[model samples]
Target: MESFSGPDATTSDDGPPPPSPRARSAEARRDAILTAAATAFVEHGYGATSVDDIAERLGVSKPTLYYHVGGKQELLGASFTLALDAYSDAVEDEAVSGVTGRERLHQVVQKYVEITTTVHGRCLHRVPDVELTPEVRDRLRAVKRKVDARIRDLLREGVRDGSLRSADIRMSTFAISGAMNSIAQWYAPSGKLSPEEIAERLWDSFAEGLRPR
Candidate 1:
């Protein structure tokens, strides 16, 4: 088993600080705000959704919404960032550590699918990038590229370990990622297939092609 280290998004001084009870509570509220904002954006389109709309949906004053997650643009950026971080973290999960390359890749695909079928995940892919400022769009792209690179690394490792057949890494990465991203556009919770079931089926399809010949 090999360990993969990518870019670190956070910086620490001396070490990481522990969260206070108030800070933890604040973070939870912020998460709820982001979720509401994403849900609004998905239902009304990012361009059509306003900070006021998000506030109304959450039954909070504009000031409280601003305090928790800032304005509309800030909320949108934060929502997309949260989704991307989830993708990056999926690959870094401790449970996948010490597993075969193919197994690690499988877990990653499963988690990616699970996240894609979520509210925040839908916003990440469905929201128009034109709604974001150029700077915010670039930042999100960088995070996404980092994630794609990590997936390619897993593919390389799998081939080296003889668990998967050799193939075009970049194309395969795009195919796998594109499929996962598209799920956010069409997946319905009320549909026959649950998120877990979708993940299992998608992984099985990818796995057959990836398995060693």
Candidate 2:
């Protein structure tokens, strides 16, 4: 038997075909729905923002919104997942950069500041944990724990390498993370300080505190 190729098919040299117009259209609409959902949740809190509110914000009928992205619960979950994944990935990536632990921690701080200040990042803290199902909340908690462990590990590495001061790692971790996480609470896009500036300013304070005597 011989294999036959259709007119639309390509040889092995060609990369995978691009997404079909319909698939692209559907993806764009789904993104729009997610954006509207995130904005509503951030602005009004999850409990007060219903699926109907998201649908109205998107200017799409409830059925259309459901067809694209399911209900309010799913949208909220997706938004949280997006924000958390970004934060986790940023930390893990910096952890493996073959640099001093203090340097890597510096990088992680900046990334955290920039990501948490975004619209999606705000979703991570804006919506209360009670709004999520037990399963979702548990899974998110695990991710956060993993990130926290990585930060602690980096602190240890800094101590061993003599790049950071000898101190209570747990208290230091708490102080560093607690302060950085609070940025989402008061961050304003139009604020005088840019994320980079804010990151630098915060890092300066942290670096001084962690410096070797």
What TM-scores do the predictions have? 0.83, 0.88
Candidate 2: which stretches are off by over 4 Å?
A: 1-15, 93-98
The residue pairs that clash in candidate 1, if any, are: none
Output the number of the TM-score-best candidate.
Answer: 2
**C-alpha lDDT score of every prediction, in listed order:** 0.83, 0.82
- Give per-candidate clash totals: 0, 0
Q: What lDDT does candidate 2 reach at residue 190?
A: 83
Q: How many backbone clashes does candidate 2 have?
A: 0
Q: Quote the positional error of residue 160 for candidate 1 in Å.
A: 1.9
Clashing pairs in 2: none
- lDDT (10s digit) by residue, model 1, range 113-191: 9888889889988998888878779877887887788789988999999887757988989988888888988997789
RMSD of each: 7.9, 4.8
